[model samples]
Target: MKIALDAMGGDFAPQAAVDGAVLAAQQLAGKARIVLIGQEDAVRPLLEKHGAAAAELELVPASQIIEMGEHPAKAYQQKQDSSIAVGYRMLHTGEVEAFCSAGNTGAMLVGAMFSVKPVPGVMRPAIANFVPKLHGGLGILLDVGANAECKPEMLEQFGELGSLYAQYVLGIDKPKVGLMNLGEEEGKGTSITQAAHQLLKVNPHIHFIGNIEGRDLFNDKADVIVCDGYTGNVMLKMAESIYDIMADKKMQDPFFDKFNYEAVGGSPILGINDNAIIGHGVSTPLAICNMLLQGYQMAHSGISDQIKNTFKS
Candidate 1:
């Protein structure tokens, strides 16, 4: 398998990206190949500093770097030669099996959707992240900022996607699915959530677990959580912030550190044709390395093939 890395897409670009790539290459020596995409000159020195060689790895030059502050769409369009854009291009063209980027979230999503396109029958690709629950495990949240405004059908589809992810990545035989809402009753949330809840409950492909309130998310209420991008994104950010606040207090919170997006790695952009893991701009070496391994795993996980079969109906 070939994994593409955005060597200059994050705040710690070139250095962090290079270091992470080296780590991944060493860890998965025979399992996968690394392709560093960015300013080769700058990245090459970092590779040497780590006492590693990228001779077997491909260096795809990207003349531009997308700034975190730039508008995602605008940056991707204007900076055609950027690492994010170039890496995505490789993914779309099948030159690489997966593309990993610790760049602007918006830019990364934009590149995946526009560059590689969504899977067949997939209306919109969703961003799914893993959050550790208080019950000593983790829950996967979908549509975490992709489509803020979603129809009931979209939410149901997110449920399907999240289920596949949980089953395959989390090793759950039958992951429980939950709809984010105000209450656990049948008619609890707004029309959208209510409609989504009903649809997911009837969807035989998933193990629907009924409604889950925000307060119950970390209580081990469900293994997979589905919400519209707007709500999911807000919840993800808020949850991360609370954890960070606690960590700042230097509290003995194992959950806060283990489940952090940066620590567990980044979120995957589901429904894309190829493996594309999106990371925050502030990702560090460990986070990037984790994302790199995730890229390798998903690329060969038969996810795209499964999605094709699922959409065939």
Candidate 2:
């Protein structure tokens, strides 16, 4: 499998990305190839500094970079030769199987939508994050920030998207889908959730398990939690803060440590026609390595093709 990395996407830029590529190259040797996209002058020296031969990985030259603070849509349009844009071009043209970036989240989303586009029948592409379960397993949460306002049909589709991701990527069998709401009882949330509940409950494709409250996020009650982007993003940030607070207090626990974003590396933009992984802007070398590995996993698992087939039927 071939995976492309935006070497100039993160705050740390070419250094962190190059080092991470070297790490991934060492571990993924003979399994997959890593392609670094960025200005050749900036990326090549860093590869050598990290004791990685230029021949070990493919280098694709991109003359520009999309800054973290730049407008997502505008930057992507103006900077045609930017690393993010180039990576997406490679992905759309099938030059690479997957593309990942820790750069501007908005730019990544824009490229995903405009480049390879969404799978047919998918209402809106959803971004999924992994939630650590108490029983040493991981749960999937969708619409983590993709769509703040969603219709009932969108939520229903999220259930199917999240279910397929859980089954194919996370190796879960018959994953239970849950709607995030104020109460576990029916008709507890707003008009949207109530309507969404009806749709999901009747959908033959999903194993709907009623509603799941905020407190049940880390428990084993549900394997896939579907919510509007507004609520899901807030929950994801709160979960991230738990790890930050623990690290500040010098607390150490295996379960709590699992909350670190570095462990999961990045979140995949599900329901898109191609594989696109988005990482934190402040991703470190380890996080970058993990992000590349996650992209490779997504491409190798053929989850995108599976979703397309499911939507077609």
Candidate 3:
């Protein structure tokens, strides 16, 4: 497995990326191939500082970096030499099996959509997060800030994608899926939510569990939850903040330790033709290593192949 690392993409840049790559290399040993993409001069010393075998890793030079505030489309167009672009380019060409980055997520998303593009018949890609529940279960949320606005069809597709992910990745067979809504009642949401709910009920591919309110997210009533980008993103941020506050209070909660967003590594960008996982900017060496492993898992999961066969245009 050839894993590409955007060495200059995160807040800590080359140091953290190199450290994470080194950690992953140490853990996997000869099991995986890691390619670091960035300014070689700067990245090499970091690897050397850690006493890592430089020859065991490949170096791909990138001439520039993309900042968080930059527009992804504009940056990709203007800065062709950016590390994020170069990393995705390699993934698109199949030189690397997966690309991992903690850089500007918007740019990464844009480059991925325009470069490798989404699978045929995939209307739009969604970001999926693994949320840990109290009773030792994982709750998967889809379309988390990947698309601010979604159609009825998009929501239905998210349900399908989220279900497949829960089954294969989370090891949940026939996982119960619920739509995020204002209330548990059938007609509690806007026209779009109502239509999506009606459509999801008949979706043969998903085990729809009716509507789930935000308050019920922690109750472990559903394994996989579906919502538009707007609602999903807001919920994720709010949940994260609450978790942080609890942690700051020094509560001895194992659930909080296990379910932390950063602790889980990264969110997989589903529906893209290539394997791409985005980590938080503040991700540490451990997070990066885990994200690398996730990229490899998703790359070889066969979920993409199943999606292609099922949704061929």
The candidate scoring highest on TM-score is 2
| Model 3: how far residue 134 lies from native, Å | 1.5
Worst 10 residues of 3 by lDDT: 47-56
Each prediction's total of clashing residue pairs, residues at least 3 apart in sequence or on different chains, is 0, 0, 0
The digit string of per-residue lDDT tens for model 1 on 1-313 reads: 7999999978888888887788778877888899999987898777767653565566789989998889999999999999999999899888999899988889998998888989889888899988787867678899999898999999999999988888876777799999999988999988999899889999989999999988877777788999999998899889888878877888766766765666667799998888899877788888888898888878767777677678769
Identify the superior model by lDDT, candidate 2 or candidate 3: 2
Ranking by lDDT: 2, 1, 3
User: Residue by residue across 137-158, what tens digits does model 3's lDDT show?
Assistant: 7788988999999998999998
Candidate 1's TM-score reads 0.95
Q: Give the Cα lDDT of each candidate.
A: 0.86, 0.93, 0.85
lDDT of 1 at 98: 89
Can you give the TM-score per candidate against the true fold?
A: 0.95, 0.98, 0.95
Q: Pairs clashing in candidate 1?
A: none
Question: Against the true structure, whose lDDT is highest?
Answer: 2
Off by over 4 Å in 2: 52-54
Candidate with better lDDT, 1 vs 3: 1
After the best TM-score superposition of candidate 2, give how far the Cα of residue 171 lies from its true spot, in angstroms.
0.4
